[model samples]
Target: MGEQQNPFRTGGIARGHRFADREREVARIGQGLREAGGKLLVYGPRRMGKTSAIARALDLEQARGGTVARADLSTLSSLADMADVVLREVTRAVAAGKGFDDFLAEILKRVNIGFSVKQDASTGVPIPQVDVSMRSKPLEEQKLAVGEVFDAIDGMAAEHGIVIGLVLDEFQEIHRFEENFSEWNLRHIIEQHENVGYVLAGSKRSLIDRMLEADGAFYRMFDKLTVGPIAEDYLVPWMEERLAPLGDGAGEASERIVALAGERTHDRMRLARHTWFRAQQAGRSGRGAVDHAFAGLVEEDADEFLRQWVHLTVPQQNVLRAVSMKVKGLSTADTLQRFALKNSPTAVQAAQVLVERELLFQRPGEKGYFFDNPYFEAWVRERTAIDLGMEPPE
Candidate 1:
């Protein structure tokens, strides 16, 4: 097998052998997409592979004779942009498996917006291209254009017997597009559609919670699903198997990689990929190799870490240092003195700010906060070890 490349995929969507766990989640999403009028809200912390799982589910739905479309809301600037994405992707998905002439006859007639057909470069198939002129319109006009796009799709789905699934990844970004009315307006438009299953995926838990609050526009509109870490039992062995193709000591090294990388899927895979590279250089996948690889990563990101560090206040830096060191009772007299925090109130305020900046996060119903990036935590410990009179992390 032409020298297997790095099996640990850290970039883009993890697919094929690179993807691990989340079988149940994928199945649930596929089932939701297959049914008519299914609404689901899938969310998780950043880098948790929620997007990857959703993509896999969409692929499966498409294979099972369902029309599926996915668009990342984070990439768009306005509702009109979103409407264009939906119009292009939905039409592409619907027309992909059907006869070109049939799609033009059935779908094009229902769509009221102006668009043109562009031929695919490789497949030679025709692709629907939305008119860019819509972008120049007023925000209100753009909103109506978006609503019209969805209205047309809903009409098409009802007229033709078809199961359609629409996935809006990073759906919470709509708040930035039209803060005052976008949420309720979208909810209203979606409620009228009876044939398209909708899956809204997001990473920011704070904004998602606000949207689902009692007084919020999207309250109880979706069935909630939160993706968490893959089980270590599955992950470690999977990592070991992936690493085994590279060199020796895969078992122990995979364990260390997962432990050091913490629970996030992308983070773990990124470290694992680097660890594989280290193994290639050192001729073995061992604990020492993993540690060396991690230190290299810390060093590589040192400048960016320093930039983030310099932006915080002194007390915020101290609180971060404390959190990095895993110090308990951060506000206790001894802990504050050890970390050089000003006072209990000061430390509390600083930590809150760190959480707001996403430099730190506390698990739900959990007492203490944690570094969102474990590698950054390592950098902090290494940089402050001498002053703090502690040994640098290995």
Candidate 2:
């Protein structure tokens, strides 16, 4: 076949027509940002497209003449880092509508924080760079700086008459900075800023839930939205449509692809992309194409998967096998015996560790846990034996 653009993509924040059917989620986020004093918490497991939906919503909000600022809080190391992200993104968004020189003067006049601003060569929008040396400052001073940044954003929104909204992606990571203190401080600051809307998004479901419990600081502080797997009814037809122009037998190919890809959005797109490539090479499309693609992907990750498998304890490995095979009642007698676990408690304990490592996950009301990565589960199925092998000698 000739060189043709693959109609599929994975990873990163998908937008425009490249995004999946997340109309409801996008609309909810947009509405939250448009509302006065709106605080929304959007969360779900990794690779479910929450970030993409939020990105699309932010674009729509900005297009409607709303000012939007987004910062990913996942990788920050200190309170000072969080402050810098908020300051940088807010100033960048503000500068998009005004002269960089004038904006800097206005911000310096209003807020006490120091910043160096420069205009981007391509977009000409001003970018604010914060001092990284603040990492060495006292923790209290850093925390105060974060509050000052939020106060400045609120003041800026009021003065400009712009509907300003902010998104802090992976907001749960804030807890790492100061335990529950960060949550309380954030809630207090957010409550005082009635002019600015906030969206706190994260992929760590368990931690997020704990933060929203009644005793937690964020309880009743924001509206909740959960992004789940795309419905098969929508995904199947959508995949088929995208594949139709590329080759014949798209219908059969799409069904097999989605079924094999399981429920994750990125996984489906990746599998679809690989299957399409295989089909194009062979001049055909079918379940065989999907199988070939799946096998190749599994093989490609064999070394990394083996590295992961070797580190697991014998009980952890057994628990993984049980979950991979969809064994119900993980702590049941039959399950313990079949998986070679010492007892119910041992099985439960090992599974909990796996859950914390993000190798496995459970839905809100589901009784049994599941493999977060379907490909890993497939690897376990194809390569490993069900019987728990004896632990290696010490």
Candidate 3:
């Protein structure tokens, strides 16, 4: 067979082999799950390794002969999709081969009496999907059906002699029910359950606590764990060690990777993957190779970057340019005036929109917002002549 692909990966869950520098966090999560139905509310900005950490912990749990089910709630578009998927994952993890519609019908027997099972018209096999008769039902009743799905899953998992670890990535999607409907309802049902070790991961702090007010649903519902940037001291040595198999300057190459990508784990891995291949082409490794690789990244991502930019309003584009330029007091009158934005409100609104879209990421407990994708941010700065201040080696 051809040699294996690059060890560094980006844009998806990092499993046991590739995930780095999160041993302590992984151990904490594993211990929580190993306890009797332990719960965790893991919070971090996007790409900061929250999902990876949960996946790693769950992998360890599975290794120890535990049942672990996971679903990315963000992919579900409707309240019905959420109910179907959660039931699907939990059932698949506990009892394999049962389709989502069958498992869902079994669970909803009590809460949703107005749904039917239908076979696939698109195929020869019996691929079934549930059809709820409550098409015009009140949103509250619809939300409650999803909550009951969780309750039923908990009951089944408890019967199996151990707690099932259910990791819900992007748990904030629960708020799609409007106001606090989904979060409040789910929180109530989840809290009363005893057979599910639930770990919820989300990037947006505001949405994570959408129901966190004193009168809120999930106010103190979780034992919160904040995932942050993997410290450079821990990361650089690991990078140097991993990069060594590639050849000569892998020992000296980690710093350049960190310099370009800073402390975000996935971004560093991606840029390093590109840098390693670039160094392979040049037959050496150093800061110089890092530069060529980065320039190549700017080129590779040009079309995508333009696609992102053209969708922005002029004010949003101006706010992004200000961020790219590293202008001081980003929402202040001085900065907005300097960046060509008309007023503080416009600049503030633009910044919030960018943040919400995750084109920009405001670090947890940090001062400024930066591009979620580091390479994209680098392109912005270089395109605008914002001087990243890195120097290629001689």
Candidate 4:
């Protein structure tokens, strides 16, 4: 058999059973779009596949003949920057099929971004070059420039009679824009356009919620969805499918590795892959099955993961350790106060930071919080010197 497949996949969408579990989510979003031109806000903790799920949904939409445009808001520094990226993607989507050249020319003219056609040396097809001169405008004027771009996109969608779906990934970063530029643009475009649907995807749940809640400008403006971890039931089957070519014990070994990785399914899959690769290496040394030796290999593979995490601040590390050791409930103020100074705010601050970073979540209807990734939590517990027997430091 070939190299064993890893069950833990951290980045990107997993195909087959890994992706199959998200069908309901995809269908729900798709149904919302069909029912009414709607805006979608997708939120989840880090490594939960929020971006991958949206990408998969967009792929499905495009396959079904709907036009899709994607913009990564993580790199965008201002409202204008995001608008430029979104506009560029919208134009490209418009120019994807036949008459694309004319379509590009029209949208460019509408947005005041000059479009020129240049012949490609290889394909001899005329490529559209958009002169995006709006980048240099003053911050105040930049909003108007962005408005024009959105208007142009709406115009193009109407003229072409095609459904335009725009996806903004890591959208929480848009808050960095001056004057809350990101939120302003989202509110403006989404409110004005009927044909253009948007999917705002981010891993920061709290921030995204604030943006969509009734108190904010985006209140009731978007349909909200939370992308959670892959279902536990699908893990073993997915691993077995990926590791099938590696022979008889591959499935069982993958399961064991997944068990080791714990609730961080993505990490589990990744560790499984590393274990499989190491097992193959061991096979060359006449080692047949992935046994205790393969387990050692998994630890070696996870060394970097361990190293990166260990570098966190003491309080951060302590908080993680606490969560791991006490997974049944949330971390309490009392627990934190034990490690922190009397009446000191450091404990509360630390807990907030962990939640903001998506490392822990507040337990619903409870006082404590829960770690999002059990494996990472366990690793922290095993590595930290903090005694599980003692009360939190005060």
Candidate 5:
């Protein structure tokens, strides 16, 4: 039963001995928190363990007597909704800490909510009834609510010396519904607030980049931190340590598993967990190391990974396929021509979208783009049966 949870966590933080790498990132975040209330923006391609890293960081913060609150902004529709959620969670978290009830009460007073304290007539024991409302409001109301939430945060900070760290996951999604509503206001509040720290993380690179760069409203408001793929050196040692308890051939098997994952941090950890589960299912045989057979299992399940890729537009699909075929390298012009795209502007637009989605990543100091994840690249190669070693025309 214990062996069952070893492989592949599709959602949430990796638990047990499954978490690998990011020691340096954790330390850096902790140090930044200790410094003059810092804001960290963790941007990476999807499924790269951005959330897991934040979760792990929060755990470390708690161990050191710090307060951390996380809010998933994906489900939130407007600025008001976001503000309410953040305030509610932050208030609850502050209330949980010893001697922090007063601080929590101060924040709660600014927000509109029904709170009932029922006392038994005879026993005098009280029951707390907290009825929270979730409703979308007008833009003006949203702005006020957001401002009040920030004010409450400021008030709490003034009373309690401890700094507050708020992590908003999928922050890019705020633009989808809010219509340039929250970004500028958030920037203003963050700029004004002293003891409040923020970590805005998102899977959408283009949105995040536009918010930080370009003449967009949030320009230069955040300290950029690109959470790249996890280091291989850290992954290798961590995997060996995780598998050591299994048996004699476990260390070698772990290496083979990591190799199969192709060094993309999240994929490597996910694949390692999957391989471990497969090995255990095969009776935890100490003699048989994780090898091509386990690799084949991952390959067989490739469709599961490609589901998101399959949803791309036809033009995006064609461009991605063309890039995959030209594995060696292809000039931007040649790639467009290879895909038989007549509209040069449209092709460029499609390519840019693909890059933003992280379906493609630019090869540093190189001309052409490459698939962000090797597994996806391999899947594309196998599906197309194309050799990408040939260089494009000069």
Candidate 6:
């Protein structure tokens, strides 16, 4: 098959993954790693494309001959898996020309994927690709010696004069480790090297921020780079190019697409892809196409959303209903009466659970709240009126 006649895409990491408009950030990461040998933190909520941006930035440095490896610690079920994965990724990237088997004994673990030698046909130099996938074995399932994992990576960076980038995606999950390997220990290894740079990113904004606080282990250590949603201008034009062939309905379809997605990078792309697919299949465009696309997303998520709703307690569902409807004065008596919630305390408790589960989040630096998953919130309002016994809005 030739190049895409279709440009809408929204699956996977930053490169091929619904990627757009982080030129300034990409440049910042590259410059920090290159000039300052910076310990940088690229963090944001989920699906904001931190992984892709970091991967792209590291690729740029690699183009300039930097040896960079991205180890997604998120893929591991047990904390023990992380140390081994990182050691393997770093060693494989700087392996010079050796294969995964060469270091299997050294790392004392085996992964399904191979990191064997490959030579560039043109330059004859090795370009190590990230071999690990998201598959995880339980902690009780496997264990490995982590003692030399960090040290081996750091030594390789120093020994090879290679600039190594440790892009630890989902850095907050380190707290979930069974053995309680604290962040301070990781910070210690990171601090020892000038040649190695680290990009720590995660979705839980509050938790990740705690890791970087003044009294924290990584205090004053990293240059904080916030990765937020892509600008509207950047997203719209790229979307238009893909939707252009759809004709008269394309403009409305595109506008509806972005409007529903609400500055979320993944949602914008996924919705556009859905809209395009819907329009193509129906041989039509415009409001109908957009609505069908919207319906399709809600429908695809119906079971999951229902499961989520069922799992919530009565108060949580009520509070979620209020939040979904964009209720004002959340803590006030009127709000309590309007939602038939027990009281302000009940509302507060329910909201906290929703936030922890990432159903809702406070708008960054704002007092107002917003749904982390907007489609699910919309679904709640559409599907729950009769079930919840709430009268339909006027």
TM-scores for all candidates: the values are 0.94, 0.93, 0.82, 0.78, 0.78, 0.83
lDDT of 6 by residue, 50-125 (tens): 8778878877877776666777778666655675567656655655432232443443343322334445565554
Off by over 4 Å in 3: 1-4, 96-144, 331-338, 343-346, 363-368, 385-394
* Candidate 2 lDDT tens digits, 114-181: 66777767777776666777778788878777888888778767776656789999988888877534
List residue ranges in candidate 4 displaced over 4 A.
2-10, 13-20, 32-36, 97-101, 113-136, 178-180, 248-258, 262-265, 282-317, 327-346, 372-379, 386-394
Backbone clashes counted, model 4: 13
Stronger candidate by lDDT (3 vs 6): 3
TM-score of 4: 0.78
Query: Model 1, stretches more than 4 Å misplaced?
Result: 98-108, 392-394
The lDDT for every candidate, in the order shown, is: 0.83, 0.81, 0.71, 0.63, 0.65, 0.69
Residues 1-394 of candidate 4 have per-residue lDDT tens digits of 4434454455667655456467777775665443325688877767766666676776677667667778787896555676667766665555553313475557656865444566656555555543445456577676766677778777776776766777778877867774747686668766877777777788766677678777876787877887776676676666666555554666676567555555554666566656556555654211234345444544554676477576667777666666665633223456555444233255556768888777778854787667676545544555553555543221
Question: Which is the winner by TM-score between candidate 2 and candidate 5?
Answer: 2
Question: Relative to the unseen true structure, what is the C-alpha lDDT of residue 243 in candidate 5, on a scale of 0 to 100?
Answer: 58
Q: Candidate 3's residue-wise lDDT over 3-107, tens digit each?
A: 546677788888655778788888888876665566788888777888888888877777677767788898766776676666556655554322133444455
Predicted structure with the largest TM-score when compared to the true one? 1
Tell me which residue pairs clash in candidate 3.
none
Model 1 over residues 1-394: C-alpha lDDT tens digits?
Answer: 2455888887799988888989999998887776688888898999999999998998777776678889888888777788888877786778654412355455577666677788877667566766788777778887887888888777787778776788988988888876534678889989878888888899888888888899977798878888999999999999898888667789999999989998899889988999988887777998888998888889999999999989889899889888888877789998798888888999999999999898899899988889999889998888965677876544
Off by over 4 Å in 2: 97-101, 179-181, 386-394
In candidate 3, position 59 carries an lDDT of 73
Best of the candidates, lDDT: 1
Model 3 RMSD vs true structure: 4.9
Model 5 Cα lDDT, one tens digit per residue, 235-351: 666676655655556666666766656546666666666656656666452324455444565487688757866788877776677775763434356665666655667666777
Clashes of each: 0, 0, 0, 13, 3, 1
